[model samples]
Target: MDVLGQLVAVPTVNPPGESYGEMVEVLHSIMEDAGYEVSAVEVPRDYLERYIPQHADHPRYVVIARVGSGRPVIHFNSHYDVVPPGEGWSRDPFRLSVEGDLVYGRGVVDMKGGMAAAILAAQAAAMAGAGDFGTVELSFTPDEETGGETGVKYMVEAGLVSPDYVVVPEASGSGNVWIGNKGNLWAEVEVRGRQAHGSTPWLGLNAFDGMARLAVALSEELNSMLSSRRSSYPFADPREAAPTVTLGGAVSGGAKVNVVPGRYSFTVDRRLIPEEGLEEAERELREALERASAPLRSAGYSVELRVTSRSPPSVIDPRGRLASALSDAVREVTGSPPRLTVCPGGLDTRYFQLAGVEALTYGPGDDSYAHAADERNSVSEMMTVARVYALLISSLLSCPGGPPRSTSS
Candidate 1:
């Protein structure tokens, strides 16, 4: 509780990306005492300038610590960064409030709480002793709220830390272990038209009107395809059984109300299940854009397509040894096997999975409160997660001889 309180008190907000050094220092001191080698993987400022301009110059850090060495290495990845507290908060977003079994704060539920739990688990394991052949590592990132481009992405690409198995513990689902996450493709399309005075609208072609037509046609085509296709994966809720398409996060066009716009554009967010191919889906979207804008193309205007970012969907087989160990730990301590499910939205686990490092997402708290005000987590659940982590690490790291002794809390 004291460790969690200290973490919650620090306002490590991401948009502006500040105050990471303070938190890293605190983590190093505690981790070193637990008999782990602690270090920081700094994201170069120049790299951030070209990749994530929003975070340019702001120091980005990935805090890493490990105990033991070699063979079956188990890594725990979590982000300490929290989204900006929007509104309607009952109290200060940085202040850690403990009421009975709950701990309230902004990042507590989103991720910092998970980080604290991993630390507790690693500390316990060290005190108990981890034999040769098993190594435990904890990696805390600084930019999960911003898509982890400069945090986890940078760490993995920079060859900072690579383990045989990874557990994100990203506040996935309350009692379920998340083995997969939905994939996404973000893009923008621009339509060009001649600008002219509103009084003589006939003199100029209206780009906004042309773009609206394309949007309608594309929406119809995407929706029609989505209806016929459903994911093979099982979801607890049957309602969300198909892919999704969302257009015009914010449509911008036209100069003034009186002026006929010369150019119009809109952003699109398309999500695909693990069964779909990312490249194929993107090609379909692009081809559809071209086909729908054909009528406007003949009128002497043009259409431009730019892909913002895209990531393939990630999934893990529950039959794998890593998952089986985690499941066994859950059953040993909690007396019930944890369900394996897929996350409805994207998270950082995709980075590790993409790197070919086996990864799973499991953590405490209701995921619904992630970006919401008055976000909190149950202290009991956090401790439970810690126990599971310790047990899993011990079980996976113990010699290949006899079954390891129980580390159940």
Candidate 2:
């Protein structure tokens, strides 16, 4: 817990990911000291400059440490990056502060805690000569909080994640093993209108009014249309169901209070179900925007919709070998079976799934604490997660043959 606390104290916030380099150095030192072969790979400078300008020079390093050899490589993946510590903290967000049983810090619960546990667990396994059957790899990445385009996505694209099975130490609390996650599409809607003095309101078209009408129409359409179909995951709550549409930001063209706005813009965040791929979801959203703009078009207002980000949903076989192995490991370590659930939000698992790997999200800490002020994780929960991960790798290697054919993408 002390070493883990030290890691949680180093705030590697994304966009800049300032502490990524430092964290990689620490991981390298630890892995090397533990008698494991280690290496680091920096994301290309040109790519970083183009996509992540804020962290253009900051290296998004991957520290890979291996133990044992041969087939059935079990990869433990976790990101070192964390969301920016927002307002409201009782103590310093960068420093891990323990009050009784809970350890509080910005990234403690969201993921640093899980990463620390994974590393320590691997070290423990190495000491116990537990890597006898096959190999164990640890990949600590950066930029996971911002959709992982520069982190695991880059690695997977480069063929750095060719593993028999992958386990991401995400904040899945303690009881749930995340089997899938929803996709996301972010878009911006712009409305153009004619501006005139407020006194002659009839002579001028109000962009604000046009946006308001569009918002209402789109909101109603999303609530009635998108929320009708619920997910079939057994762990999903019936009342807390379905994909959702959220209106994020809205901007009006008017600078003065007395003028009729000429231009308005708004952003939409659409969470898609597994049945709808990224392209299909975007097409549906485009149709909705077009339908919503019809009223404005009739009233002589121009509307345009542009997509910002599109990510696909992912689902791994819940009853497959990888899932069963992880479940048995969790039960052996914690004395209880794990429940499979769908993550309501997006994560790097989408990238692994796209890369054709049998991957799942499992780790400590509650999802509700993610990105929240004074984020924290239970020390005992992290210990349990470490044991579960170690046991899962061991069980997978000991099983006859390797991962079941069904898990092979």
Backbone clashes, each candidate? 0, 0
Report the C-alpha lDDT of model 1 over 285-326, residue by residue, as the tens digit: 988887778888998789998989888888988888788889
Which ranges of candidate 2 are over 4 A from the true structure?
A: 53-57, 197-203, 239-241, 249-259, 403-409
Best by lDDT: 1
Candidate 1 error regions (>4 Å): 131-133, 399-409
Model 2 lDDT tens row, 1-409: 7777668767788767778778888888888877678889988988787777776877778778888776577888888888888899889998889888799998887788888888878888788776676778888888887778888888888887578888889988767888888888898888888998988989899999998899889888777777668777654565434777889565546668888889888899998777777887788888878887898999999999888888888888898888988998888888899889888888787788777788889999987888899888898999999989888877777789694433221
Candidate 2 global TM-score: 0.93
Candidate 2, after superposition: displacement of residue 260 in Å? 3.0
Clashes of 1: 0
| lDDT (C-alpha) at residue 399 in model 1 | 34
